[model samples]
Target: MTVSPSLSLAQRLRLWVSRPAGPPAKAVQFDRALTPWAFLVPQLAIVVIFFYWPSAQAVTSSFYLEDPFGFGATFVGLDNYADLSRSNEYRQIAGFTAFFSAVVTALALGLGLLLAVKADKVIRAAGPYKTALISVYAIAPPVAALIGMMLFDLHIGPATQFAALFGYDLRVGIDYWDTAFALIVISVWKQVPYNFIFFLSGLQSVPVSVREAALIDARSGWRRFVDVTLPLLAPTAFFLLIINVTYALFDTFGIIDVIVKDKPANNPMTLVYKVYLDGFKGNDIGGSSAQSVVLMVLVAVLTVVQFRLLERRVHYG
Candidate 1:
């Protein structure tokens, strides 16, 4: 069927008009909106400058050697990494870091879980308990470290006084084993409060009805907790696991440094602390950059593993 000439012309005109008009065509449209980009540009620039740029520079520096003048960097092609691996100091520091991280993460998570569960069952003054528990987390790490140092320092700390009562000679300048244990203790002390907050939030977020249903089915206390409540808290548990592990690895370095600066080769010095020592103290920029890369890889792997294992178990609301 052939269209009438008038109808054909009318259709053509409609199509032509509907084909967006000039300035209106480019006018702040949703898909072409500039506001979001305008808002994002500053943040993007900051990230590029602070995070991406430095990260890129570090990666490049990892493969190079710096001359005495610091003007020219020579390509070393993984020599820094090879030297790092061969260094007994690197192995010892890494081993200490790993052991400390593992122990502190485990203790923090365990104690946090216990506290969260106990707080969740509060018959009275739960709010006070929660506030007190979480208050530790609000304290600055440096302040906390100073307090710990004051408390545990062998010469005048309360811990030394307490240990003396137990007939234990605990002098606190810097004992390798003692400092390592103190670092772990202080780490757990700081981290447990943070983890408790998350765990408590997670526990409270679990549906009351589901827990009641479990009780109706004669699932009491431990069984109900294991079978019902635990699965619900899995996502929170996984999150805290990752966060606590990362904190134990990276954030605790400052605390360790304050508590064990003189004992870098012995105490619970982490990979981050080692990197700082190499780059700033020892002037081994290449070695530090390589260690930083290794640490990034380690964290990335652990994060990926956490998601892989817990993704299926997490129940999204």
Candidate 2:
């Protein structure tokens, strides 16, 4: 019958593969060199606009002393970074960030592994239960923070009341460590569902034959798990370690903000939170920009270390 002269060769091939009653073989061949870039242009533009441009601005701003009003930029050339390095408050912020990230990563990874193992063991209604467990990850970060705040509210919180009965208060506005601890718990809870999704997928990918062989050799279930299952899950655990640390470092700002109620009040504020406070609230643009640069460098260094040192133990299969 009649063929569409406008149809490109790739489009015609796709149509032919899907249906026999497709257009005739007379398809127009288009230039290939620019086709790939034509498809990529939209996405590349978005990335440049949203990511690269802002990053370049931050890098440039870090070298300048500016105000919150986005005017009167004077090039200071490393003075911002030098001042940040010498500040006691900045050092305290770094300590807070380290402790918070460590605790959140450990708790999230540990709980995720435990939950994934348990979920894997479920033979009945496994799909529904696993879906339910992972559904929390679908919640937005700010919304999750709100939920966490509500749950641990000192006066009206159910979890707080429940904890009070056990002689433990998990509410805010208590002590510096207490606030930090509550924030850590919220961060871990928010991260666990994501980590659980990955760990469960990794556990399911482990060859059943290998597990059965381990079962035949090891009499104890825990022993078989430690020897066979844990090793196999190492790659997944490593990935989640990086993600959890990132979430604790950057994404937990919402939860920290909610808990602090706008005033940190001598609380253990993280480096990321300090960046926000200094730049937005305190109106010290140069300091915040420098902090952002430091954070970027720290993450890059840690990622390199993970690839170099920790990745050797990862079992792909």
After superposing all C-alphas onto the true structure, candidate 2 shows an RMSD in angstroms of 9.9
**Residues 208-236, candidate 2, lDDT per residue (tens digit)?**
79878997999998998898999888877
TM-score (all chains, Cα) for each model: 0.84, 0.84
Local distance difference test values of all predictions, in order = 0.78, 0.79
lDDT tens digits, residue span 218-265, model 1? 546898888888888876776666667678777886797788756565
Candidate 2: lDDT of 83?
Answer: 99
The CA lDDT at 114 in model 2 is 90
